[model samples]
Target: MCAKTLRSVHEHRKPASLRGRSFKRPTTGRFDINGDERKFKKKHSKANGIVSPMPNGKPTTSKKVNGMVNGVNGHAVVHMEDEADTSSGRGVATSSKYAAIQEQRANLPIARGETHSTIPAISIHDPSFATIGKEALLNEFREHDVTVLLGETGSGKTTQVPQYLLESGLAGEGMIAVTQPRRVAATSLAARVAAEQNGRVGSVVGYSVRFDERSSTDTRIKYLTDGMIFRELLSDPLLSKYSVVIVDEAHERSLRTDLLIANLKTIQQKRNDASQGKGKGKEKEKERLKIIIMSATLDAEKFAKFFPGSKIIYVQGRQHPVTIYHSAQGQLDYVDSAMRTFFQIHVDQPPGDVLIFLPGQEDIESLDNSIRLYANQLPPNQQEVLICTMYASQAPGQNAKVFNATPPNTRKCILATNIAETSITIPGVKYVIDTGKCKEKRYLAKNTGGGFDTLMTRDITKSSAMQRAGRAGREGPGFCFRLYTEESFKSMALSAEPEIMRSISALKTLFLIGGLDQSGEITQLGREMAAFPLEPVYSRAVLASKEYGCTNEVLTIIAVLSASSKVFVDSSEQRDAVAEARKKFKHGSGDHLTVLNVVRAYKDVALSENKSGRREWCRKHFLNERALLEANDIREQLQQTCERLGIDWKVSCGDGDEPVIQSFGQGLAMNTAFLQPDGTYKQTMGQSTVKIHPSSTLCDKKAPTIVYDEVVYTNQIYARGVSIISKSFLAGLGALKVRQA
Candidate 1:
């Protein structure tokens, strides 16, 4: 199910530009690197001139208060340790330890924000930084095996806590892991923290996400998506390399996050118990694992209760008062209401960027066009509205444009999906328009055994509403205009149900793929399947491909299916062109064969064409090159995995597509459906009737029997990525009778 929430500070703060230079910090009293307090004699600077507190020490036209502009970088001091050796004269240079510490302190974002000031301060504006002393925070972590920290948005917990543990040497010789729900958050937060550490990414700080990873042995603290870490568990079941695992955005409770949470409990118990039996010394203590579960909402109690002895520590967040206004009645059409609200804010409110939250890309695009059409009709005296649309499927260039600075006399308006609701800070947003609606993906389990994903729009939970409103307050005092009434908000659920409760359990999917036995225990085959970063079904397909002697073709198609973006880019204006281009690779069997054909054609083109020619070829065919390149990466990884598993990835079935289709049938047996008397298809294992998706090549074809990749419910139950299969071939697969436990 697709889940969307409002803009809230769930985990990260946007990093400001460092401008390719570092600045000196104030000569504040010394602080201990190990979370202790220390004092040293102040050193004098040789120059009497004032150094601008900003990066590069340059003056700007923008006004600043306490070296800050709208709660962002300006004259902020981050005193990590002493600057020089205090045992000797003031001019004496310190040892390499002090030098490294000084360099690190200068590189901090807060230090770059500061001017030449003598005032001693340590992020007084951040609730977590201001309220929780470094020593006290470390002490709690040192004392507890697990910590349930309830920190509001902008609390500095996500960014600061890792640094705190690293500096205090609490992480010992092992790396510290911080898991995010989204890849964008994982990579961006790593960049921000790397900046804070005065080091480059992939060195002191790194991140690992699917298809892309930038981490090395030098990395001390790593940020990775929950899915990546969960995959890591397959290789290192006990997570022996990590001393601490901080699960950020625990409130979101995504499917992968829930899996990690459950597995962590068992992993922690085993690791800690084994370490405890090793003689109860400091070295053995370092072998134990530590967990910190952080949430932005009121669900910390739930996590605390789950961990039993885990301590719940609440950290106040630095938030400016956000004036919230609810509508007098319900909004029948949220898109229309959002458009009206944007124009109202543009014509009536003071200057500042406006952020409008929508349910999905369709709504975002609708509101974007409406706002643009109306903005042109506004009087010339009014500020022009600059619109930016954001969603998961948007191009990288389009998403990057959202972070660009607003032009003079132009009011920036961001039309975003729930992606903007958490772990991202959109600058210049002082007014928010929340559409109290979101789309959630739910798995409708059938009594007969199979299930389909349902993407349905519905009212958001109260926690989501607060998160959406919190976006406006990121920079400074802001206002939130809720499209729904206060009563509507009050009647909403307190929080979202954990993803495990809404979707098919991962264990069930694993069991279906023979990853687990009837007794619910992982098998050796399951362990091998987990080695590849793929869905269990796709992994099963690869294994079956080996037996079918179509490993080469199956790998190509599965890689494309696993790509983050769609293989084709569809545009309304280019519908005819896209259709005509698609005909070159269209296969009569269906989408799966069509994908293999496209990959083969691309390979031929790559061998014959130059870089520019390859780009032109892709452009002409309306193919997404990024998706192709990503697929290539996944295919390479899968090939290596296959080699390790003693399965020849180069095994091919020549030019015949039958073996490839039959191989997929082996893995997708449960996804099979047969033609019904009413000219529709009924699932082989379930009673649900489904139609071939319009995008499928076999949309209007009368295929007697077909196997699909998945079924999605929007306006109707539609089977996507379909291929025809012989009934006799499907009947040979007796595994379809495997019942749910």
Candidate 2:
């Protein structure tokens, strides 16, 4: 099977550099050693919404590079060392005290090579680390040159690869950077790596997140959310200090990773030129950083082809043989079949935890209610089962409980959303129930009026199916009971959709960077974004605080809204009451303004009483207390960004924290749409058939409104709504849309 091939590929092939062993010299001696028949990496089609260099010393690029729909140069800017490793000015090794540091890192996981460009040297560490098997290596790893690391959920590859390189004597010149798609992954992985090295979290292995960091002077291995690493590239072009950069979970194709790969390749070429010329600063360490991409199910060959000369290694997942069963007869009936399966598995199945993947919040709730009703059907005390629901929009406390386990003699049933596909790892899970469906956000190609959007519940992709299966067997040999047939899975796409074509891009912040003053290309602002521990959109929002003269306030707002940090309360009455109070200040600008008003109102409450009193204030309005805390975190980060950029950050709630409304409308409306007289919406930029979602506060209202997500996701874009706003805030903020003229 595929697993065997994964092992064979990495085990057999000798690193290409083994042939050039004789010419290997310290640092720089010859371009012959550095230059090869295959030096530049392969390239790929670029995604949309990325920042590019404008023709007039601006952000937009003259020509769109690769297949990128929007304007952007597709490449990651990895730091490069002096070409050929010539006598370097500031090298990590060859220095005195750092040797001890290097020696101590021997136990850490790293790639095998001398500098990033050079493979393992005899004087360095032995080239052979873990014997992958020769024939397998030659046949698989070398054949494609792009490795798809599909290890079962708990494989050591994610934590060990960087350590392997460091120990193998590869990349001795700088730290190893690993990009994780989520914040939890970054924080936990860094902690785990540090623990293995006996150093404090901040020393050998560290992490830098939006409001937190475990990094210090002695750290060499760092786990960073993908965006943070991207931002770091702004200051350290060539990513010179890193020996290797690992792009993890690339199949997810989160916007940051997609943009980063192109940047890294671009920087590697720049490093070679700088070292070859009169460039100064530690530009003498000549080595094109090696990029090791770790994906679950995405096409590794595609990436391998994208980056020429890169090596690909596949790690087969370790999953138990679980019988995949389809919906038995009445399966199409929503509650009936799903609930029936739940009872049968919980009572008749083995003693492991169960994970049932559903579509959206409604599905999770319906299934949960069915299970509870089924629980009552049980004879008293016959079975004490613990049931939990998992969804993106759920309250924080409830979601946490789902990740935790149940008491003894009680079985655990986790009703989950797509978040379980990769985000969180549940400890005791051994069985899985797949709903075979997921709700995804879809962008209408024609809709440009920019008022609202739409979402749909669709079948899960094969990669997602496999990912769900992998979850069951993470701890040991586990089983996954898929609800769909293998035939259905085969028809699914190999990967999820890329971010650019779907999500919003923040070109506003890119304009502020020292070097980049436009949304099209990577400039100083774009580069600074690559360094931050936040998403480009959020990072842009925070960075823009400088322009608007509100750094302190924006920081707090962003931190509170990041990955899994949203804090909307559950009670609709309370939510409505709070919303109503904040609505008094509604310039009718948009949702963002509503949020601002809430924040300002919160500040007023916080000032009147102690922290506990503030919590009470949040409770009375149905607002999440945690969200308030996160807003505070955002503000703090904004404040720090101000300090770093020398921008003045004055924290004040004047105007009740409301934004200009008109400006925000412009940004949100660019991709929105407007409903026509015939009831069919004419989307922004000339698209059609899009409907407003049902979840918007303006859902039942007759006035046209701009929205954030579709009905399947949040219900404000695909069902109904007049296009009173411009596709790009076209209707202008404060222009109230009444019933007709």
Candidate 3:
């Protein structure tokens, strides 16, 4: 599942630009029309500098909040409130505002620690529904170990049954953490449930996202990301605090979700004895963990068999009558035909936003371009529909717009990835167009080695098609147009493959972190890695940082690279700036040394000014302030890892440029390459004929040389590869190979 909440770096301040150079930050000024000379939350804004917060699912523009713009470089200081009130006071009262949600959870005939207002619940009273459905399901479930949940959209099983366990108190004080594949659902559902219980959101119905957190100790019904819940397992093996764990959006088959199910099964076989729990009152906390799996169209029967004694409850969704249609014309000129179909539906049919599914990023971009270009040519009456794009790679501001409503008389079009499939709930999506395609990432053959990573675009799975179809039928009777044939849909995979079996695992990461064997089970050092809230590789980097006394350095890199908080200034000027950076390092080594040399130079420059000036100066050099922030996080994690190993991270930050190469080489040792007799060098683990990316330092020059810069494990070798040798080693390796040449 995707991360629930990605942090916002720019909220109000405008990105500053300088003449004759790239964007420059405030080096000395207190305010450049924006206060405190803070970094911009967004760039290229036409609006005056005003920052605003989106609180009620409504989109608002920048207007300073309490005199503060949600500036990118601004610190996110959680307004520490009275923990009690902040935890549970307003959730129940506020949740009463929604009628449908209130009817489902609050009005149910149930017992609880606190009494809820009496309201009648809508029940499925069909005789057939009661007799053959659940009872028949029980018999099928009794004989199975894993089950797939197959139900239409609006299935009550997703939300209601989790409450079934809660009301039964089968979960006990042990928490029931349900992981949603998307953030909006996690946060919205958490608030809805908290309000039902007459408690605060964070208290009993809390959600823990990346930047926005609303969970507290009183919280018993917690909603989190699939990955977040998975990581939590490493911290609490038996999940002693939670009695029931629900994996929502199982059809998505995200990488972490797959790992979570497998890990859960692993834990179940060798159940962690309650007596072994690290938490206090551990044994008394030993409660049977309940596994509840829910999905829109999953094969629930199969999943039930996977876990013997597991029960599957199917709840029908509130989906309205939806009519499916195929494009009028055949395959050729289909994109144009698709637009005509969309235009006809928007004008002749009804008023609601349109959800269009495409193969991948390229397809989404192509379809969106066509729509926008057509909008300009349309009549004045047709030009009113506000067109927007939605994809994972989109900037933060753009993604937010897809969820908000369009102005009156204007229709909004949402172009999304499979991410829009199940977890996210977009209002007004009454029309859906399916492309029957999705981009998938997979590893190439090991014989090709690490250099050739393949990004294959494949046909959508059957579950993906159902998910796309469900998007249209949410509000009322809607229309869906399919680009492919029904036969093709039937031939598709039953479900998207699970992630763990497909993608790269932390085998290398775990090996380094815990020194574990290939299985990634615990090792001496890995024991500490298991305690961290990050992936094994990320944890290993932190541990290694401590050993090298570079704790401060690693943290900054991680925070910046993490992409969530950074404004992600993809400036073309980074290459030019590196050229300038090398001038300070005396060009004694290579690009790795260039970064170290430049960072030191920047820090020294900062010492002459305040931290505010430091940020401004960084932007001027095409450097990212947020990257520096992440680097600091990586450093701190490393420092902590070292302390756990009884090592003090007090070593001074080093400055010698030549020694820096050797330091980088040890861990990046696997990246090293050697020149062959014919002058072709092998670099990748699979030794594909790879070349450096244009952005790498090695790409700028060529000799009888083997350099490491711009490396990836695709079907083809790429650039920006990092190597284990210094520039001097290049000369030595070149000498031996030059004779062969």
**TM-score for all predictions?**
0.79, 0.67, 0.68
Angstrom error of the Cα, residue 529, model 2: value is 10
Ten residues in sequence with the least summed lDDT for candidate 3: 1-10
Each model's number of backbone clashes? 11, 125, 79
TM-score of 3: 0.68
Estimate, for each residue in 260-352, the C-alpha lDDT of model 1 and write its tens digit.
888888889998889878765678978899999987645656677778777666554445456667777776666656766776678777999
Which ranking of candidates, highest TM-score first? 1, 3, 2
- Residue 260 of model 1 has an lDDT of 88
lDDT of 3 by residue, 1-741 (tens): 011110011111112221111122324322121222211122214432211112222223322111112221332211111111233335456544444444544322111111111111211111233323333443333333333444444333444545555665545667878888766667766765665565667886788764467877777788888867766665787776776677877756677776787777766555435334555553444544556676543555455555655544444333444455543323333343345556656656567888887655555655565566555545566536676666664544556788776888788888888767753567788898877777777666555444345566678876677667656755555667776655565567767667756676445534532448556566776676565545555455556666555644444433334434432333222556645643554333445545555556666877798887887776665456555555555556555756776655565345543333443433343345655565445652334665555545555344333434235533345645332355464444343333323
Best candidate, lDDT-wise?
A: 1
Each candidate's lDDT (Cα)? 0.73, 0.53, 0.52
